[model samples]
Target: MAGILAWFWNERFWLPHNVTWADLQSTEEAAFPQAEDLYLAFPLAFCIFMIRLLFERFIAKPCALGLKVQANGPQKAQPNAILEKVFTAITKQPDEKRLEGLSKQLDWDVRSIQRWFRQRRNQEKPSTLTKFCESMWRFTFYLYIFTYGVRFLKKAPWLWNTRQCWNGYPYQDFGIMFTHHIVTVTLITFSYVTNLTRVGTLTLCLHDAADVVLEAAKMANYCKCQKLSDLLFLTFAIVFIVSRLGIYPLWILNTTLFELYEALGNFPALWVFNILLVILQILHCFWSYLIIKAAYKAIAKGKAGKWNPLHVAKDDRSDIESSSDEEETVPRSKAPHSSISTNGTGGANGTNGYLTGGTCSEEH
Candidate 1:
């Protein structure tokens, strides 16, 4: 184990040439970040989780009520052991062939079976108030984090000039890193170990700013405030694009990829960190494409005067397309050749979408 640890901590890989671990050691006057500090984060996270529960109950729920966010109770499907078994054990949405077999077995028409499935699916969806609370919780966190981040960064030179981030190179400042699981987490963990927290803060701050708008849009959407939702969604798209595509690569990536190299010279771990940033940038581009596509579709629909409240700002990555209420009104006899076509109705509770998170970094 010690041999493996020694090999992994080789100074040549992690630090700049000629800088040994001894050189990076903390003294009484200059205390460095310790890995043990991370232990506090777990307990803090638990506290936050508990706070979320209370916030959702006391704060968000009341706010949702004030906004008049209606919670439509789902219609329960009549009890049927066979269909229930199929829904639970087999598929929520059955294929055409499976539908036919079930139709024959139950001696029921396809339309009735389809309605049951629709009702069944709706039953599984969260209540509109529940979705509102969840979005509200996220909005509260993102807004607070963004506000705090802005305050923190106001005095930090690198907030204005990215190049200043590398003025002291690796030794003069402490920093943070973040990312998804596996590769992203590895990047974050390595970056934190290397004391790269400054850039990490920028990445996190940029991300939370956009999410604040996204969650607000979701909350507005849940309340059926179409105009507010659409406006907020447009704002979210702009923020997402500017932060993820515009500033992230131009400012953050530039500093990390170029300025850092110029300041500290090449190291194996630095190359690893750069590769992870590039990967994150690629993800940004992919999600940006989704946002652009959604925005274009919204524009075209608006021009054509085919505005759908349910579909307003509906990007599946950011929002899921709920099954329409109008579908239930269609006569059972007029049900499409494929019941599948008529089956996708949004649940009674209005959580009609999802949003991906940002930030590819680790903490202090």
Candidate 2:
């Protein structure tokens, strides 16, 4: 077991040939990333989580209220022990057959059962105000981080010249390095561990830049500012596509995959790093697709042109009624389609953004 651990952690596999762990160690003049330094991430994360709670309570919630964001969703489901059990243990959504079974079991009409299920689902989902607060907190954080990244990168030579990224072949003055989601966390961990801080910092800044717009769009959505939300979502789509697909592939991928090979030649660790970067790019493409789809839907909906605050109440009532109608004959193609960006970064990016089943919600 010890032998396997030693072999797996061999410096030759992680670092470029002729480089050793000692060469990357921190000195009085320079500080390099140390494995043990990751311990700080745990406490820092806890502190940040606590700060988020406070921000949501004292800052974001009040801001949402001031903006008159709705504090509640549809009415709650009435008590139904059997339905609750099925919802918890079986599925939140029941098929026609299951609904029939439930209707018969509860001695209720199918429509009531469907309404109960819908309300129950809404009950489990976050209120619009809660979503607003969450998005507000994220928007604030992402905006701050992007600004800080710009300030930090202004002093970085690589920010101006891509070739400067490979100047010293990974052993340079410790400068650059730096998310919360699983994908973000994984990227950060791998980049820092490999001492690819410069590239990592660039990625972080790009993502944060996109996230600021994305969160703002979400907040606008929850606030029922349809025009602003559509506009912001469109803006996010452009930014995400430009940054993640165009700039990322041309700048980051080219530099890491092709330029690095030209500069330093191939190495096992470099391949590993490049592979991870390629995977991230693939995810970027996936997210761009979703963002574009959502943006296109926004344009089709004409939300930017037809919005009226006074009409919202009536529209919302219609929306709820249509959603609750089980026998409605609306075509599946015309049904409102929502695209979620999983990573939570891009205008609508996050793990929550662009996977097969991303969690990021682009509710239109």
Candidate 3:
């Protein structure tokens, strides 16, 4: 509770007009969580998680339905009582050794145990509608926060002059900007940790990258490095666009299709990070395909992609493995595809697991 309060209200008291670093550290000065204190994140994150749950239940889900985005599939896995108990007791992600122990104790083979776990995960995965709601929540938050930040600082004397950012060099810290930096980082980290994704991994990382760069750059600007800050914000904006729209579909889609063969040639010695990067790239392509299709529709028919998937609800899309849901449909055609599908199936991208089902031939 204290941590949750801090996430929202701490900044107000901690950083006031013309506040300095010493004001933060000096017990004789201002009040609140001490400067440099970071232990508050755990409770704050937990509270955010709980808030997400409540919002999804009461707010996001209802909105999704109104938008006509219903996720269809088996609601839950009918695992045995023992399986259910174990599933609830253990962490969602278990290490191999623990999984092995569970397999033996449950008198099940490793493969069966793995399958059960996968199904359980699928059951817990949010519906596409729910995901849309979650996104709306974030969009609302970021838009508000960014707007407020700009409004608050736009006319400041420092903003008009580049020299203000670098006046005192690197050691300076403006209380408000400092507080903003911490809060922004906490929010982004919270978002990343809360999401359950396999293919969306790279997108998340890229988002983190873009957000961190922008925030840090702002901090530098506050610290008197306006020139450097401008460069960073510009860079951040470009990367965000490219990563979200351009590279995600065009570049990543192409890379996933062509790079797999190159990767396989040295499969035994493949770079771990490179492999992870490839997997993430494929996932980005999967999600962004909807946006791409929407763009195509708008171009072809005059309107699309703004809110179709959440509202139209015809793709039968796979929320977990996008291939499974198919909530919206686009023209199917032969194009290069990736090995990973929205549902971890090969059919969408190829005909076999880890193979391009139709090689980007068609999409939903």
- lDDT of candidate 3 vs native? 0.42
Compared to the true structure, candidate 1 yields what TM-score?
0.78
Per-residue lDDT of model 2, residues 1-364, tens digit only? 9999889778878777777778778889778887676777777788889999999999999999999988766567778788888889865456657755765565655545555665665565566677678779988988988998899898999988877887885567775455332223665676676677787777778777778887887777767776787687667777888998888888888888887778767778888888888998897877676656655664688546333211211223213321424343221221122112111221212211112211122321
- Please state the error at residue 341 of candidate 2 in Å: 37
- Superposed by TM-score, candidate 3 places the C-alpha of residue 257 at a distance from the truth, in angstroms, of 38
Per-residue alpha-carbon lDDT of candidate 3 for residues 1-364, written as tens digits (9 for 90 to 100): 9899666444333222343334434343333234234455566667767876887789866765665555463245554687677778883534556655665566554434444554565676555454555555554445445655556546544344323432332223333432222333432333222111111232333344344444443333323344564455446545555765575555433433444334223322123334555565565456455445544664577432122322112323323322342332221222234212222233344421122111111211
Cα RMSD to the true fold for all candidates: 7.3, 10.2, 18.4
Model 2, C-alpha of 55: deviation from truth (Å): 0.3
Clashes of each: 17, 17, 31
Q: Which structure is stronger by TM-score: 1 or 3?
A: 1
The Cα local distance difference test for each model comes to: 0.66, 0.66, 0.42
Best-to-worst order by TM-score is: 2, 1, 3
lDDT of 1 by residue, 1-364 (tens): 9999999999899987767777656776554455555556666777778999999999999998998886654556678899889998864567667767876677665656666765665666566677789889988888987888788788788899877766655465543322211113566566666667677778778878888888887777777766777787778888888989998999888988898888888989888888999999998888778776766777876632222222433422222223434245232443335344323222233222111221100000
Position 184, candidate 3: lDDT:
36
Better of 1 and 2 by TM-score: 2
